[model samples]
Target: MKAFQELAETLSTTLAAHGLVLRGGFNFSAGEESPTGPSNAPAKSVLLVGQTGSAPWPHFLRWWERQPRDLKDPLDSWSREVIGAVAYEFGARAVSPSDRPFLPFQQWAMRAEGLKPSPLGILMHPEYGLWHAYRGALLFDREISIQAPENPIHLCDACIGKPCLNSCPVGAYSADGFAYETCLSHVRGPKGAPCRDAGCIARNACPYGTEYRYAAEVQAFHMKAFAGL
Candidate 1:
């Protein structure tokens, strides 16, 4: 167990410098079900890896700029290179959110942290609001003891007026559900410059963890990716 803890700590510290954190994890040996069903990778446990706020944006941008422009999914490709190297060093298998046999990351997150979904369908983090994101996971052949985070206060429940529902001009988010096509159409239209340049208006309207909001450039980058611009 000491060795496992040490390994986890080393990986956690190394990832922290790049603004990624050991979000949560579970041991399949302890009878915790596999979120990805069955895998032949000899994984005995899985560690959830993610980022909060915009701390990684600058570093990612610098690294991304240095990569060949012709490469597809540069961000995901870069993440695979960095995280995969770490997994290799630790004798673990690295998996990404973009990987096939698509792992149920949202389920893994909820089970590992007791997190609830927000109005926009994204997991509502207590400290990062909607600004946080899960990037990838590391699958180990040995079980590592990991403590689940206590259930946090659902900030959305207490929010009066639910600004996220009203902030989008195209009514992309509402009580009914998100209007995916409506949003995409609006974002690709002539009037989409604001959303294209600054990210989703509804997401920015969330009051929780306002301090962790991404910078304009970072937000714009994400918007561009979402819009395929």
Candidate 2:
């Protein structure tokens, strides 16, 4: 147990240098779906990697500035490179949310952190709120002692106004689910400058974790990407 804790700490420190955080981790249960290793072996444990707010912006910007400007999905590519290196050093298999077959990353996050989805479909962290994101996961053959931490409260349950659902100009998010086409059309249209320049209105409306909110530049980058600009 002590050794595992130490290993986890070291892993945390290593990720921190790259502005990443270990959102949480968990060991697989019997007969559960899991990520595979080189030999098609099932992973016994998983550690989720993510960033809080703009924690990774500085590092990403510095690295991005060096690469070709025409690269598509730079953020996703960067995440793989950084997290892949960490996984290699730690003797783990790295899988990304963008990976084919799309590993159940959202479910894994919920199980690992005991977080529920907000109205916008992003996990709501008590501290980080909607400002954080899970980038990838490290899969290990050894069943390290890790499990999800439970948070007693779901922020949405207590939120009365639900400003997030209402802030969108297109009403993209709703109980019926996300209107992806409507959203995409709106974002690609001329009126999208507000969202493209400042980020999603609904996401920016969340009152929680305001301090961790992305910087204007970071938001602009994401918005442009989201709009496929």
Candidate 3:
């Protein structure tokens, strides 16, 4: 147990240097109920791994540019490579957000961080808003003690105007649900340049965690990715 704790501490510190954090974790020893776990593996715990804000973007982009572009799903490939290496070093299995039989990352994140979804369906982080992301996770074959995060105040609850809902030109997000086709069509249209170049206007309108917002370049990259541009 002490060894595992030490390993966790070391991993947390190491990952932080790369702008990744051990966001949260859970123990799923035999007989424990969980909606998401390795179906074919003897996993006893899962560590939620992710990044906050744009701190990792520059580093990731730098590495990404150097990788061969011939491969499909470069971003997912990179995440799998890096996180997989970490898992190898630590004697665990690495799983990415893009993996087949997709792991319920949102559920894992909600359980680990006590989070609630924003209107955009991205988890509303008290300090990161829509600026954070889960990259991958590590599944261990032995239980590791990790405390569940105390629930933070849900920012969307007290928002007066809900600017996020009002900011989009196409009404892409709303109480009814995201207008997927509306958003896609608009983003692919002539007037999409601003949205493409500056990221989602609605997401930018979010007042919480303004300080942690991604840089314009990072935003543009994500926007392009979303638009398949």
TM-score list, all predictions: 0.92, 0.96, 0.92
- Cα lDDT of model 2 by residue, 95-193, tens digit: 999999888999999988999999899999998889999999999888887644877488889999999999999999999989999988988898888
Q: Give the whole-model CA lDDT for all candidates, comma-separated.
A: 0.83, 0.89, 0.84
Off by over 4 Å in 2: none
Worst 10 residues of 1 by lDDT: 32-41
lDDT of 3 by residue, 1-229 (tens): 5765787798998787778888888887568654343444567888888898887776677888887876566667767777888888787788888777777899889988999999889899988888889999988876786766798999999999999999999999989999988998898899988899899999999999898898898888777888888
Q: How much is the lDDT of residue 36 in candidate 2?
A: 86
Q: lDDT tens digits, residues 78-104, model 1?
A: 778878877777777788999887878
Q: Candidate 3: where is the Cα deviation over 4 Å? A: 1-5, 29-40
Separately for all candidates shown, the number of backbone clashes (residues 3 or more apart, or on different chains) is 0, 0, 0
Candidate 3: which pairs clash? none
The residue pairs found clashing in candidate 2 are none
Task: Spell out the clash pairs found in candidate 1.
Answer: none
- Candidate 2 local Cα displacement, residue 228, angstroms: 1.3
